[model samples]
Target: MRLRIVVLFFVLAVGFVLAPRAAAQSPIVVVSQSLDMRFPRSMRFNIETKSNTRITVLRLTVWQNGVAVGARYSPAFAPSQHVRAGYNWSFQSLSEGGYLPPGTRGEYTWHIEDDAGNVHDTPRAAYAVEDRLHTWQTLSNDVVRVSWYEGDAAFGAAIFARALSAREFLAKQLNIQDIRPLQIFVYASKQDFFTALPPFSAEWTGGRMFPEYGVIMINFAPENSDWGMRATSHELSHAILHSKIRGTLGDLSVPHWLDEGLAVYNETSDHAPDDQFERMFQLAVLRNTLIPLRKLEQRFPADSEQAQLSYGESYSVVKFMIEKYGAEKFAALLNIYEKGAAPDDGLRQVYGMNQDELENAWRDEIGARSREISTARLPTLAPRPTFEVSSPLASPTVLPTASPAPTAEPTRIAQAANPAPDTAVPAPAPALPASGLCGGVVMLSGLVALSALKRRGGRDSER
Candidate 1:
């Protein structure tokens, strides 16, 4: 009876000590639900301990299609403290072996284990397969290629090709095919583009145009803004123009008006400040500073004031030429100018009109329109604000009259009648002496008289 009592006490003591260890080794329980998304999406799982007991070692094993794919673990934990949480695992359908066939279903399961080697299996997470478009990539050059981010490959490819074709056409027109091949960057979302160029702000304007390097950066933010197309076309036009005139004419001093006018003409979209043109026109008409076309090339209103006028006039002039001369003639004019010919000469060669005549016509058209608008019932007129016109570097050439172009057949004339795009006055032809004879005629006569006197003296000596 004494031996039995001693053995029973020893066993009870051992069992008491082992019970706490067994309880501390209990498995961790994990719960999870399958992810569902209406649109293509991404998900992250956050695992956290709810109990105060520190889990010394906790691990999560992920299974996709019955195969172990990824695992995440917690850092070392101490008693009575919830341990470090983690989210270092991810599964993408596009990843290899992660994709399921369309109309088929698949299951994902997560298993949680604790330091005691106890395992808890989560309920099966279900997912369905859906169709996705394969993105297509086009190598623009050795360093760069365009790829579709979200749109259909066919549509993206079409837009890319169209941009390239347009650039090529402009280059050929400007005779600058040697410019480095330009790369086009297309993004599917504004957020993706934010990584490149920041969102447009009115204060932040202007872009780079490096014809020598053959790169053009286009920010398609505010994806719907016409400014994007206009800016792209404008920069590309500069590239084409630069490539053509790089080394010619001792720096090829193209005036701002001509450069910007050509850009506006080629742009397929309108800019945000387009309405400013009509406003300037009305103001100029009222203020009597509406510059005549003849004088436009030589002089402009002061800086900001003239900038508005210059743009308005350029748009109107280019529009008129396209309407009157037709697209073919307009294109021919550009071709001629791109070939190192003076703009005035190119215009005269193509249009058969002098700068003076064109200016008069433009002024008359504007004046007539203004008069007609005034005659019509004017809306409750708002008091027009008076702002000082920025003075131009030089006074604009004034027109003698506002008249339309002559309807009669053009007369063949020797002098160029057209003006440069920036100058209203026609460039004077190389000057000629008043008389047909060269300036040396008087000297030649003096030489003849001296020769005659010498011959007479020689005759006397012979006598």
Candidate 2:
């Protein structure tokens, strides 16, 4: 009896240790799962499963390649032993919030639950978002892959070469040691390029860079490869710089001046002068009307002329800093920003000065005096203007102030002349803990919105 008791206790201990494995097993079996890539329109997810019990719940989860959190959808299906589930995810909704750029990759999976309490999960499948309308030729090296449909292999080769050179120049300048792989998709015409972008993209947009996905799309003809090369270098610089600063908490708030400054300055691998921006910068200096660097910390002016001046000043100041302070210090400053330091705080920590001081220093270096501060009396500071009694006989009627017009949407300004129809909204999908180059909400809210600043493609093909 003692021996039997000891054996029974040992059996119970082994069974307890294996209980989780046993519970994890389910009678449901996934027969097959697949994704149909429709490109620029919609992709359908289809799954078939069999179970001894009626399948009560079928859920589908989808996410971009680098992102951790996925959006979950419950595909409607009747409870039965054999279940088929499918959902057609429309790209039309992308115009409202998010986008899946051409060449972007993603994954999907299916979850099954049955009335008998059995559960099963289909293995994850991968899909690449592409432009199915065209047949693209691709050429790649370790750094970047160039794809083009209009040009020959040589056309793709030229862009690939320029991209490699640009990567080299930026890595050396910024002390970037490791670079993530990048994809460049060349669209031969403006219409083709616009097709790849979300519906509401600006009409003037010539090129766009989706840094989170390491993708750049540009519209330039084969004969204009020169401009294409420069644009490639400019956009590639943005991607590499963003990669350096983006962290688990999402991208740090690197000042707009610094971000665009570095990109415009690096347009040429040899550091050739940008004559247009340089001329504008000189004009600003001569007029003593230079924009305060502090003002440029958030955004540049909207007016085209003022925007040009802003860009020129930014390039000049960035160039001056690098030439005077050395690349190591500039790189150190970027590292500080990556750790979440504010613009002034990062500059102060790295160089012991703030935006105003830095702007003054750059001004002095460029033979310009410090920016003047106006001391004019404000309308509020002035005593209320004496009112004449001429209206006393007729009682003056004070008109109400007019409200300001609504500003254009932040970046992707769809042309009003060609408006897309409203799309059917999908049911709210469950969200997972967000993690990626862009965080959960920002990621789905069109991570490519960063390209807005580069949308105008200033001057020639400068995007």
Best by TM-score: 2
Q: Per-residue alpha-carbon lDDT of model 2 for 171-251, expressed as tens digits?
A: 555655455678898888777776776657655565777665567777787877766777777788877666556532354
lDDT of 2 at 34: 78
Number of colliding residue pairs in each model: 11, 0
Worst 10 residues of 1 by lDDT: 434-443
Clashing pairs in 2: none
Tens digits of per-residue lDDT for model 1 on 1-463? 9999999999999999999988865456443233433212323334444333434444333332211122222323353334444433212332212212222233434434444444444554555432233243554433222444454556445545445544554443322223334444443443443233222311112233333323343434333224444545655666555544433112332333455556555555322234445567567777877665534553344445455566666666666665665655655655454444554565667777544455555566656332212234324322222111111111112221222122121111221222122212212211111111111101122222322233222111100
TM-score of each: 0.38, 0.75
Point out the worst 10-residue segment of candidate 2 by lDDT.
387-396
Error of 1 at 225 (Å): 3.8
Can you tell me which runs of candidate 2 are displaced by over 4 Å?
Answer: 1-25, 94-98, 247-251, 372-462
